[model samples]
Target: MRRLLRLTFRYLFLALLAWVLLSLLLVVPLKWINPPITMVMIDRWINNSSEDFKLRQTWLSWDEIPTHATLAVVASEDQLFPFHRGFDMNAIQQALRERERRGQLRGASTISQQVARNLYLWTSRSWIRKAIEAWFTLLIELTWSKQRILEVYLNIAEWGPGVFGIEEASLHHFGRPAAQLTPMQAALLASTLPSPLRYDPANPANHLRNRANWNLEQQRRLGGAQWLAPLNER
Candidate 1:
């Protein structure tokens, strides 16, 4: 029992050390060397490793995607991406209150947090996982520029089964490049993020259409991507 305890302690120490090193790598100069890996690559790797997981298929660069595409996503998913440090405390509080009212579990992870989770963490829901997610999110925000964060988010966010980034999503859905996706197409894509499997962009359900329309209105109200236009150019 004593030997087992020692071994457990040793492993725990190693795990903690590795986690710290990884956090540093993600947040520091190491990221400069890693370049950016797209969602398409990640999805392909996941699919190759396991028969259970499969993505629709898509990949896009920051410039390849239209300004409205980013705006639509931000308006629909996270309106305060430019201001948030990493987590949106207000949204978290609201989500918790709503969950209590509904007697169900819900989430309010912002785009930055979601990017951290999707890029580094596994698809598991637990307090421990969430804590790790928060840590990585902090690191990402500290180390990466806002433009880099959004670029990563756009490339990695799952649009549909096998469809990964805006580029692939635009080509698959509208037979156009992501840079050319219209406001309606961008809004439709943004609407699918909540539940891509359930919401078909080609034939949006009533609820999805309403949600997309709402996002479009929000984008228009926010000055049509003026905030993110500069980022897209970078």
Candidate 2:
């Protein structure tokens, strides 16, 4: 019994050590290296069976993706992207309160948290998955700058059923490259991000149109592309 217990503990220690080291290896280099594929893309490729399902992604460097495209996502998804460390406590608190009052879950994930989960995790809402996501989120924030985080998020984020990244999304939606995306076109893309599978940016319905317009308004409110200047510093 003593030998069995000792071996169990030793194995557990090794497992924990391996997990930590693996996470560092996964995150640290990503500060400079773009990921070839993300877990989210793999999940979509495996599960999606619709006729429209087509896997596509094109990496555009930060400078290649226009500020309009970048700012639209920041305005629509997480306006606090440049300021938050890894999580947005205020949004989390608000989501908690909303769940308690409405008995429905709402997402309050920051851009950093979304990057961690989309890049490294499976699409499950289990507590275990959340815990792992939090671990990766911490590692990402610690190892990479805010700009790098957003760059990865834009590159890896699923824009539609199988379309990924700003470049592919721009082409898929508007028949233009990311750099040529107009402010309205960028806003339209941003509006689909919350429910990319459900909302079609190419032929937006009434709600999507309203949301895109709202995103455009918010972008102006956020002081346009200049709002992202802080990301350069951190």
Candidate 3:
């Protein structure tokens, strides 16, 4: 029993060391030479047999995507995405306060954190999972630029049943490519993000339409993609 325990401990330490070294290596310049990996790929491999959920995503370069799409997502999901480092403390606090008042759970995940969780973790929500999410969020923010983060987020964010990414969502919902999505279409897509399978952009119910319109109004107030134009230049 003692020998078996020692062997298990030794293997665990080695595995952890290997993972740390690989993570560090992934941050190096060589990472640029490799093809970008997104959450969709990881999900397909990890959750292939899961019967309860389905998701499909394709990575699109920043140049291939229009600014309107990102702006729409920002308007609907996280208005302060561009300004925040990784987490949004103010929004988190507000969510916590609201949950306390209502006696229910609420989500306060930022775009960056969502990207981190989607790419590396399971879907279940828990205190331990959230801690792991924070750790991965910090690693991604430190290793990747804002543009890369947004690009990855756009590619990984769920749009509908078996549909992921702006490109797929645009084509599936509106019969348009992501690059050509109008503000209304983009806003509609963004609004469905909260519960993609439940909300249909094709013929959104009253609540969905209202939410989409609200997001569109917010996008207009935020200067509508022009705000993100500079990031593309970088």
Q: Which candidate should be chosen as best, given TM-score against the real structure?
A: 2
User: Of the pair 1 and 2, which is ahead by TM-score?
Assistant: 2
Clash number for each model: 8, 0, 0
Ranking by lDDT: 2, 3, 1
Writing each residue's lDDT as its tens digit, candidate 3 over 78-178 gives 88877888899998899889988997667899888988777677777787888878877887777777788788788878777667789989888898789
In model 2, the worst 10-residue window by lDDT is 122-131
lDDT of 1 by residue, 67-96 (tens): 788899999888888888889999889978
Q: Would you list the C-alpha lDDT of every candidate in the order shown?
A: 0.77, 0.89, 0.78
Most accurate candidate by lDDT:
2
Model 1, total clashes: 8
Against the hidden reference, what TM-scores do the models get? 0.81, 0.92, 0.80
- lDDT score for residue 180 of model 1: 81
* Candidate 1 TM-score, true structure as reference: 0.81
Writing each residue's lDDT as its tens digit, candidate 2 over 1-234 gives: 999999999999999999999999999999999999999989998887887777899998887878888899999999988877889999889988998999876778989999999999988776688789889999999989988998888998888768899999888888988888888888888998867878878899999999999999998888988989989888
Worst 10 residues of 1 by lDDT: 30-39
